[model samples]
Target: MQTFTSYDGTTIAYRVWEAPADAPTVVLHHGFASSATGNWVVTGVVDALTAAGRRVVAIDARGHGDSQKHHDPAYYGEDAMARDLVGLFDLLGLDRVDLVGYSMGGVVALVTAAAGRRVRRLVVGGIGASAAEQGGVDRNSLVGAALIEALLTDDPSSISDERALGFRMFAEATGADRKSLAAQARASRHTPIGLARIKVPALVLAGVDDWLATRPHVLSSALPDGRCKVLAGDHLTVVRNPEFAAAIVAFLAD
Candidate 1:
């Protein structure tokens, strides 16, 4: 695992799967409560990118994966995470990269691209129009509160919301730090992320059955150059789709 110090002195962890030197690098950001391995590597994203002759850099966001974890709510948020991503790019001397981010990472990607950073192309997965219209990641507000409660609660049965409960179960099943994730949940921001500021070609990819990504085109239409495509499954199963990587590879390659 390679490491870089973020702007706030946070230790961010990333892994590089090298391809030919002339190959373009693709940076990947995983979903919330998920690490690079869980979101990209295990799901065959890294392998697909590398096999396609592209150098892949998969980063574990703060409070997730092998990155530094903290329980303070102030330390966690998509804005902060986006800063870390930009910092990594600057630190690594990456002039430009094709970025692919899923779920929470998609929010971070939107924030980064909206800031007019050095992204050549962008692929936002598992996110929809409502998220693009409103503040950063819409953990759904009330749904978000339920998630926080589910993460910190001692009894799983107490979480009545099926989605939030499932999230809690996924976190536990993955052996993630519940406290850090809770802090992340607590820090969910509603600030508007200016997607219109991004001027790069982007692909809005998601599953037809995914609730979080209900109307993919709403997000696509929001961007200057963007389009939407949906696969067969829901949130969890979407990444497993071969077309997921195929679509991303094709989009970034173009």
Candidate 2:
């Protein structure tokens, strides 16, 4: 529940779980419509990382979670989101750190990491480059909008239960704004040029059942220095899976 000011003077929110002083710091960026607490803390991912002696910094991206919400769709671009990360690091006085991003956050990490040398190691889960290549028009475009509309019904309880508790949590945390959420999705839908510029060690993880980031299409050619891991489950379930977390830890440790 800490806050920092971005370059644009937007008050960004982040939660830090400190481990041993010597442990490597890892930053977690949640997907669209997800907050640090809902996506990582509530799911026990932040706790797991801290218990394993890693300092975890999880952020609530602009227009989502507890961060400042600019209704302007223009502020949701990948470079803009990436600048937020850079602003966070600058605000915290961090030189370099490992980064783990899911969904839209993954695209931000990719663009950020590609643009500079600040990331030590990177793990991208539940998304791929195609979503970026497609200019952010993934299945979520249809599904997310539908889900948002469902939330505005007389009783959102039915819609909340459809994707298990995770979707419900996401819907509640985002305030169920379809236009702003979709704008964020659209903002993340394009890949930045120059993949070969990114020289950092990277791991790209995609869920086998994730329709948004299909295996053969997105993972294969995403990063110039990227390694791929295909796990079992859909996008939501994959982030919390113990095996998936372990893989991320192992990659960062290497």
Which model scores highest in TM-score? Answer: 1
Structural similarity to truth (TM-score) of each candidate: 0.97, 0.83
Give the Å shift of residue 209 in candidate 1.
0.8
With a 3 Å backbone cut-off (N, CA, C), the pairs that clash in candidate 1 are none
lDDT of 1 by residue, 22-72 (tens): 745899999988999999988888878888899989899999988999999
Off by over 4 Å in 1: 21-23
Q: Tell me model 1's lDDT, rounded to 2 decimals.
A: 0.87
Clashing pairs in 2: 132-191, 135-189, 136-189
Worst 10 residues of 1 by lDDT: 133-142
Can you write out model 2's per-residue Cα lDDT over 1-254, one digit (the tens) per residue? 99988888878899888777574589999886777876687767777777778988998888878888776668787678789999988888788889988877877787778788889888877666564465342554345555444534555655543542354456665575545565665455454445667778888888888765665235536566778888887877777777777887788877
The TM-score obtained by model 1 is: 0.97
